[model samples]
Target: MDASRQIAARIEFLRRQLVDREPGPLRDAYLAVPTRERPVLQGTTTPALTQIWQQRPSGLITPATAETQPIDLIDVYLTFEEIFGFAAGPAYPVKQLQALPLGFVLQFCAELLNALSRPGASHSDVDRAFATQWLKEPIRTRVLNELRDPRRALVVPQALMLLARAAVEHSPDSLPDGAKPGNLIGALLAFSDMIGPSGEGGPTVLGEQPGDLGREVIANQYFNNNASVPHTFARYVRRWRELPQQFAGKDGLVDLPAVYEQCTGVTLDDLTVVAGALWAAACNGNVLTPTAELETLLPAGQVAKVLALISADLETLRQAVQSERARRHTEWTFDAFQQRPVIRLGAFLLVMDQRHLIDRAFGWLPILDVRFPPDTHPRPTNHEKLAGQAIRTLRRFSELYVSEVLHSITGQGTTTRRVYDDPELKAAFQGEGQKIADAAVDYGDTWVVVEVTTSQLQRDAATAVPGNAQVKDIDKLLEEVRQIDATIQALRRDESRLTGVSSQIRRRYLPLLLLTEGFPVNPVSMTVIRERAHKRGLLQGQDVMPLEVIDVEELEWIEALQEQQGVSLLAVVQRKQASSLERTSMRSFLADTITTPLSHPQRFEGKVSKALGPLEAVLLKRKQREP
Candidate 1:
């Protein structure tokens, strides 16, 4: 009989005896069943218990009904097979599949199958596969799923981190792939943003504990392994870089918590994961500042584990960064060259112009051109454009600057030395006449003058010259000179109007001065104070003293009348208050007009006296009016 049939047959024979029940018969019948069915026959599955209800010949269930029903042996074995295919070790024969409790057996078998599949696979490939799947069905879907267990949803990001960490530890490609997978990163960030503000339940990212398996895996590979960590570290460092001074806290960094709270939704979670990733990454030989405040909450032993992991990964990250840096420099150099290619056919004209201009202006020796064959030229396609394209191709490198190339050519700060030193560029212009003559050639008794102008000269030495100076005719050049002169004169006049720095000391704040009185300080003192404030960037750098002052006689009269009525008139009126007072007065006037308060003689007199300031007091005295 098949295994399921045999087990079932044994169960049936035991059920018959349970109904008949004789001690000697029961013992013998239990022994008759197979070893696998023995436990069922005895009804002693761990924490031993017996069936309370059973089927019987009568309508009601007795012990016999429960016993005769017979467990679905086929379904039980099929469920076990469906859950876990493997039985034991990697090399264990599949033919030796044995029976065991379903849940326990499945756990062991699934783990074994996974291990068997992992052998020669790379981390990057695994990361890519996971990322593809994640992008299509991200954790956000699960987080939003109404039917999902909240605890399971909460741990999804950690699970992703776990897989990423495994790849990072075992495979170099995995770290790079995981770091650059924008879709996966975006989903993770979105989920984190949603959770950050909720602040309910456990932390989403794993901490450094054995129980925190996800974090441990990330730590082991990112920090402890030989792969570089900056790929991970950049996840955080970019945020804090170039932080504004005023926004920074007492620690010289922005208050992360407050900033995070202001950012609603999934953003807060993104910040946490990014910060954690960066911390781990930087520990692996990256150059970002190790902010200690972030690490203070972690346990002591985990810190040591992290440090060890970083030590292991440092070299890999270092090499990767170095390779990237060198690649960047190369592309930058190529672009600078392309943007300003060396002079080929037209170099002589530029040389001539430089010599002529300098000799005429300052009587200096001519600057020599670096010699090369006429054909020795930069690529017909711009060298700089090619370099720029190449440099831009690099994913994370910062662009190259002119200063970097200048440093490579003549050490740091050489452009200043080359352009401004001693003879000055003006002195080189006079020798242009010599350059024009040398570049000319005679053909068989026919004389021809090759036109050598500053434009041609500029093209020749574009790479070397700081400014693009090509000699145009007197009119255009004269116009340029006039524009420059005008600009300089304007600047000088503006400078003369500005107050000296010493004025800052003279206009210093005077303590105990009556603030409401608008203290009668000197005009110069007020002007200087205003100017100083403008220079120091206070009041948005507005020169209060320079602004025109105007008087509002109507407002002054109204204010004076208020003061005469015994109201404090020191109020510095504001727009909001003025609007409110206007609204109230209009409402009061309308209400009084509508009610006809003047109909009562005493009330009318009283209202008139209050509004006209004691006018009614004079009018009411009949004797005083009898003149």
Candidate 2:
């Protein structure tokens, strides 16, 4: 097939694999179309994909105000239960239920759905239908009721956002002429409330507020700073200016101080007369202004117009103080303590600033969200000389601890606990310091003292913590430490002797045994025999075996002898003994016959004696006898 047809067939196979259905004619269509343009022809969903896509509505529709309609609230509640499998509290009172309108029921539905979606879905999904449905419900009343009923109000911000969006979506009339509107304040307020007093604002809903005049103002002034106290204050100040009617009295006159005090808890007189100066300084960017304001706001305060001014800027002031507090906490300067040539017992010198130390140890670090900060650098308050002495003592103590407990169990420097912070102790252990230092816990109490110096502890009884480490216990580490040391010493002493013996055994004896072929051998007996043979000049002095010294002619001769007899070298020695025995037997026979001839007893005796004497001599005088 051509390349294009092959490609078409491959595409059909992939479609079948993914969707579990054959492409068939569709494969031909796909091949006919241009590759890049094929993407446009694909449907939004296929049979395999539609099952997961359209199961739920596009957006999470939270609680909203329902339009006027006579409907069974119970039936709507049941519908939600059927759809989402969520449960609700005891049904609303039937009497109260009768007075409730369609709007109230829609609001209830939105809230119920939002609660159900929280665990699995995002808040955006929950906020989608808020514009049309949930927002129409009374935002404040619903929020207040949520606050009172903890169970129902458990999801404050999400519920509020839903209502806010619903109100914005339904109230086209609330927006200015020919201008698009959004639920900027409602979203912000909902976020702020959701955070509650603890400041957990939950997930951000939109990228940013849409472009609406009122929304832009709210976004920059209030929501921008998030956790910044000053930014929160600025936001409240702007909010006060925009919503004058909310703070106005029956006479239609705005009560500025009341609004400021309510939002920031600062009085007007205090703002103008006392904090007025600090406010001016802060506006000009003076660092000390916040501190100055704290002093003013706490003391005798002013009221009326002055209070109103302070109230207007309350959030700003709060933010400034918080910023100043944060700055002071982190502004630390290090002082190098001069080294004293000598240190006396009980000498007092500040080690570190209590404030910084406390903070470094346990202060709130917003980044980590937990305490237990690391003790970074240990700055010495004493002179270098004095500090050195203290470090020496600490190291000595740690080493002693390791030696006492770990040495007995595993041996002195061999253990893991013997290292220490002291220079002397570390030097003493040297390469083994890590091992010993690790065992410090086993030695004794391994507490670190930041306050006491080594010199002080030596001179004053009170300076030393009672029951310091001892030498005897340190000696116990010797048990474990000695194992490695002993092994090393033994090896050094015997290596030469063992190596020489092994070389002699392998070179001289091994080949001799191999050549003999059937020589009966025992390693222990062979070793003994070889040593004796060496002393007796049987083996050569050079330590090479004698047999090995033979040339190829001798080796071939020995090999041929064995081949002809079908016997090993051991049998050749036995055969030489048999030849000697036969010669002795012949001589003995001749002597005996000559002495006892047939009937001549007297003369035969004489002849026999002479013959026997000569024969015996000849028999005894054979060339050699078997060994």
Query: Pick by lDDT: which candidate is best?
Result: 2
How many clashes show up in model 2? 54
Q: Count the backbone clashes (under 3 Å) in each candidate.
A: 41, 54
Off by over 4 Å in 1: 1-155, 172-627
Per-residue lDDT of model 1, residues 17-68, tens digit only: 4533445444444433334223333432222234445433322354533222
- TM per candidate: 0.13, 0.15
1-627, model 2: which lDDT tens digit per residue?
A: 999999999987765554334355454343322232223224311332221111112122333322211111101111222212343222222222223332333234333332332223443333333322433445434433433322222233322333322332232223335544343333333332322111112223222111122122221221111121222222222222222334344333334434334333443334333323332232332312233333333343332223222122223322433443332311110111001100111221111111111111111111111111113323233334333333333333323322322223222222123212234323434454232212111112111101111111011111111121111221222233332223223223332332232222212111111110011111211333344344444324242222211111122233333333333322322232233221111122222222332222121224323312322333344323323
Q: What C-alpha lDDT values do all the predictions have?
A: 0.24, 0.26
Worst 10 residues of 1 by lDDT: 508-517
Candidate 1 backbone overlaps, count? 41
Root-mean-square deviation of every model: 39.9, 46.0
